[model samples]
Target: MRFLNFPFLVYENILKHLEPRELLLFSFCSLKTRTLVSRMRHTPTYTIFILDKPEKMSYGFVEKPEKEQILLSWTWKKIAMESENLDNRTRLKLKDVLLDCRVTFHRKLNIPTLVCRCEDVSSRKRFATALHSHMCEVFHVKPEMQFKLSLDYMDELPYTNTVRDVTFLQSSVNSTVADEFFEKFHVTRALFSKRCVPDRLLKHSCKFLEIKNLFVDWSPWLDITLLLKVKCENIMFSSSTSVANDAHLIMDNFNLEAWDPEVDKIEYDEPVHDYCEELLYFLYDIKKYMLRSGILRRQSDGSRALDKTGSYCSS
Candidate 1:
């Protein structure tokens, strides 16, 4: 059909009703048709996976809350699966089909454009690194898409740069993998659950080492310097015994004097009983020291810091 021969408004109206998979096919008809499809405004809000295996290629999708249906090709050309039912693997120049999908969608769609999902076949497992490397060399994959790993691979990952966001299967990985991932990606926002923060996180001084936010089980063995380096803010942990020691460490080298009072906020899960008493005695002289140089006023340190009856500020 001569799709481009229609009136401009009519062509657009027709194109808007078509799903992304349909638009992809429309784009392949001709360069002119592809250009028209690319310029369309409405974007589909659906996720589609084009499954390809050594012998068959199939695809499927789910519109928002619907269950994703998997479809397979019985015969490539005789009884090919429709776009409404595509799922994984490697048929066609998959890299090109994927690139064209991105192009026709004008690079905006609910679905993350798949480069290669062909990890393994029914009874045959292809070399993953070789396949993925070839895809990277040929196609341009957007870094924003999440790479849902079968497991947080223990060995060194090859295409680290392409993986921006990662989701690990539960009980399938350990802190070592998470640590390695953080060290490599240096992703600004990161989360680690059910695992202890590893030593690799503390020792590295990489520019990417500035972890803006982190969530992990607190261990007393953790070095206090790591918290300072990670720039953790307002996070509460229940190590009552270590607060006094940590308070002293903070006062000595964490440069609490230079920190902006209005901006920096720190919280402890434990009460301020032992920590307050210990910190007050430690700070009494340091407060006097800061005031002696005229950096802090003596009146500011007068009774509030020295008083033992009140809450945080004594006097």
Candidate 2:
């Protein structure tokens, strides 16, 4: 009678109540239970990278820097994965957790494509380079197969002789932090000739390569220009800041007289209101508040804002 089948939910509840070690043993009770209960939990995909701060290098030690610059702080933020099927609620939670943790760069940084929440230059570079290497070794996703790659932030290092199109999710045109990035990543037309980037990044790419956040400077006209650039055809640059009215902007901007009007109209009629508007707004707003306070400033105007309508403001 003890072996009679229990309701799936009842068995699942039993498994949940067990300890980790006990749960493993509990699974062996029935093959049906094993499969059902095992798959119930959400195991978030986490890419463990090396902790960068000089102190973190010493394994368990913490180092104090010569200057107390909060911007210099680093951490190991979560990188979005192609395989993870995280729901929107879970994704937002992950972003929150990552903002509080220190950003860590992976040891061997050149994964063809990376999706990280890290905002630091050294940390971002390290994560990309190390991820590239890891992908090559583990998943066999080599640079040769990397026809498109998007970095949340661009590092100053040269490509590993195999990458094609590089995209950065930059948040500003000029900031003290931007200087550190420019110093590291060169963006002469010779290196990354064409880019999957916005116009602001294009200007910086003339001298340095960095990606701009869509929310930081959202514009429908700009998005169309970026879409037509050919370099960014397959790029995903929509961020929350531009979600409100950017789609209309994209449609209006891309709707040309030369191309078939009906086809253009069809494309324009696509349903992306929520995808482009609310989600992006949520993503960008949370990120802006969590990362650092205050927007990058412009020396000429001395304004303290990050919107397209105003000049940059320093903290």
Residue 215 of candidate 2: its Cα lDDT? 22
Candidate 1 per-residue lDDT over residues 142-232, each given as its tens digit: 2232232323232323334333323232334444555656566544333222233343432332433344333333334344433443442
For residues 1-315, write the lDDT of model 2, one tens digit per residue. Answer: 243378767766776675432433334345554455446562322111222222221111011111111112233335543443332212111111212232233445311112234454554444335433433333233233121112322342323443222223324443344444445443221122122334454443332323221122232333323332233111233233432344564344332123222332211111122113433343345435442222322233332222222111111
Give the range where candidate 2 is weakest over 10 consecutive residues by summed lDDT. Answer: 57-66
Give the Cα error of residue 132 in candidate 1, in Å: 13
Badly placed stretches (over 4 Å) of model 1 are 1-5, 18-33, 42-90, 94-150, 153-171, 179-225, 231-245, 255-315
What is the Å distance of residue 198 in model 1 from its true position?
11
Cα lDDT for residue 306, model 2?
Answer: 26
Taking every candidate in turn, the Cα RMSD to the unseen true structure, in Å, is: 13.8, 18.2
The whole-model C-alpha lDDT of candidate 2 against the native structure comes to: 0.31
- Give the Cα error of residue 151 in candidate 2, in Å: 9.7
Top-scoring candidate (lDDT): 1
